[model samples]
Target: MIIIFIASLILFAFLYMVSRNKYDEFIEPLDEKEFKIKKIMPIGFWVMDKINYRYASKYDRNLLNKTAELNGGVYAHYYLRVHWANKITFELMLLMFLLFINGAMGKTDMELIIFSLLVMAVVAYALDKDLENKVSKRRLSMQIDFPDFLNTLTLLINAGMTVSGAWTRIVTDTKKSTPLYSELRNVMLEISNGKSEIGAYEEFAKRCRLPEVTKFVAVITQNLKKGNSELVDILKYQSKECWELRKHAAKRLGEEASSKALFPMMLMFFAVVLVVVTPAIAGLIGSV
Candidate 1:
């Protein structure tokens, strides 16, 4: 076990040294704040680039690209590859650490091997789960912010502003930089850069990838096409509906928070019970 650990450690060091300079281009642009795995990214890139096997399937690629697009903007494709590489690289590092620990402890049981493998699997699953959670949080943020944007846009349009002008006003005047607002800013940017309004809105919907945003974009595009006279009324109705949805989302979040707290509360209750009863039981035992 010790020999294996030493050899593996040497090999990893060699790989890291050889690949660090080779993959600096890919690793340098990754922001540590946005990417938790940025530190291991050079070795990760090497693993992805040098490993001959196809680690990601077509379905995996599509799912990753979609998820990355939501989080990574224009660099979605690059990020998808980086994420996969980082996952595998991190798993390999963990496995090496386990090997070293086993060597040092002189415990080479089959159970330990199985446990190490399970840990690797758990880490892999956890990384993917974290990414999904980020996407979910982003969607929730956009959902929460959507109602205010709709109300503002409706007001501006009712006061005789064109939809484009109203959208620009709301986006420009807002100080909040939420996901919905950022996407709103993107749409205006595209339009200002010569994209058609309908096209820009469609792209915005794609980037957002939310049903609520999709419905809102559909209404706007329809208005642009057919010139809906009751656009303000329609927007007002949607805004009210979105506010209701936001309330429901908030309630659900509160319930989730309470449930999450329940386990700790249970533990504390048992601890207090033990503290209060243990001395009394000890006295009774002494008397007996």
Candidate 2:
């Protein structure tokens, strides 16, 4: 048993080292300037510290930042936390399962430990899939609201407000009620603090990466450059298209719900008929 425990520890250490190195290979370090900026920002600082503590290397931080950059860089901290937490949770679960299996099977500790590592690998894969699904759902919801947001901007612009002024008005009016509203509000704040409208819009597009938002930004940027006056019409058309899409989505959801309920509804109907006829059938049999 003692030898087994020693061997298990060695194996676990080796695998952990291998995974850590692979994670390092996947990430490139940020420059000294970016690293310093990350340290100053509260959220970035937390993410950096968390990654360092969990991963025991700077490479983990790079991996997380790269992943976030790939997704548009706005939610890097959130993604890092998600990935770290998921890995920790899976590891803990695997450890517990291994301990349980060892006690039940009277196996050597090393065998159980190896089995636990295998389980953790499987769990990590499943957790990644679950996270992807969640992110996709959130992106879809944000996209659904983009057209209405664009229309609101267009209306404000047409009514004699400057683009910045229109965004400020919308920010006040929205009061951050929706996800899109909050994101827009942040963009507005960025603009208020000296960022150019075009730069802010570009950042917003990067964060969202939705086709509608990209197209809207392209149109607005062009109009700004060319002094175009037809933005209001374009906004109206986009709004109408988005509304139609939303309606279609709603209809589809409703049909899916109805289809799912159909089976239970038929079962209930048959059950009610059987209950009503059973007594009459018994009475007729008694007469016979």
Candidate 3:
């Protein structure tokens, strides 16, 4: 009893000491050689990684890469290292939690271990979901900003600027720190570094990896290389299409907002009904 508390305390103290020494060092697998799977990781990591990689086939690499890119992860391996490191931390933390729970509550070893693993599984799943949510947020930002970008480009191009010039102008003038504008800024830098207009546009499309953006880039590239004629009309068509997509996105957002509000709305309704009925029910009970 008292002895168990002492043991748990010592175990958690040792965990803190281990975390202080190992936490930052484990997360810095960012050097060039870190990707090469040789001597950079901890000693026993190879065994754990061997077990982890067996399940790696279950996840989508392209989706993971895109999510990583959205979060400024240049290489997929950087995120992988962070994920595994965090997972290990969770494992240790949950093990300690189970130990403490067992010591404090007199739970059996099997019961505590099973409960801990179940909780750890849920938390681990939540970590993957967090990445998916990040990707969705970036996509939403890009969708919301794309329409304004198209309108601005059309306006500048119609105002006697070449496509490349209009693009650079928009990149410089816009103050919105969205993913779309950030990518545009990158494109602007690429152009400034002597990259051709077509190449920059192509890279932007690839980085964005959106259907609408890819289509728009293809339009720009085609018009830039071939003779530019009726470009304003083409841009106007794109602007119209962009506005339609924007409206659709807004409607979807509204629907999602309404759906989220339903739970709170139901709670409020139940509260109001209870307020009206509670006194009546109490009076009836007293009479009976």
Best by lDDT: 1
- Which stretches of candidate 1 lie above 4 Å from their native place? 52-59
Looking at model 1, residue 124 earns an lDDT score of 90
lDDT of 2 by residue, 1-288 (tens): 444445655655554444443333223343434223222123322333546766436866765544453344765765565456445534543565566566566656676677677878887777656556556655657767776677788888888987778878877877555556766887888887999889998888776666777877887778787877787788778778777776766676688789999999999999999999999999999999
Candidate 1 TM-score to native: 0.93
Worst 10 residues of 1 by lDDT: 63-72
Per-prediction TM-score to the true structure, in the order listed? 0.93, 0.61, 0.78
lDDT (10s digit) by residue, model 1, range 1-288: 888899988888887887778877788887788777676667777877777646478867765656664664567767677777788778878978999988988868888899889999999989888778778888888888888889889899999999999999988899888888988998899999999999999988888887878998999999999889888888899899999989987887889899999999999999999999999999999999
User: Residue 191 of candidate 3: its Cα lDDT?
Assistant: 86
lDDT of 3: 0.72
Please state the error at residue 128 of candidate 2 in Å: 1.2
Give all candidates' CA lDDT scores: 0.84, 0.65, 0.72
Query: For candidate 2, what is the lDDT?
Result: 0.65
Off by over 4 Å in 3: 1-63, 72-75, 109-115
RMSD of each: 1.9, 10.1, 5.9
Q: What alpha-carbon RMSD in Å does predicted model 1 have with respect to the real structure? A: 1.9
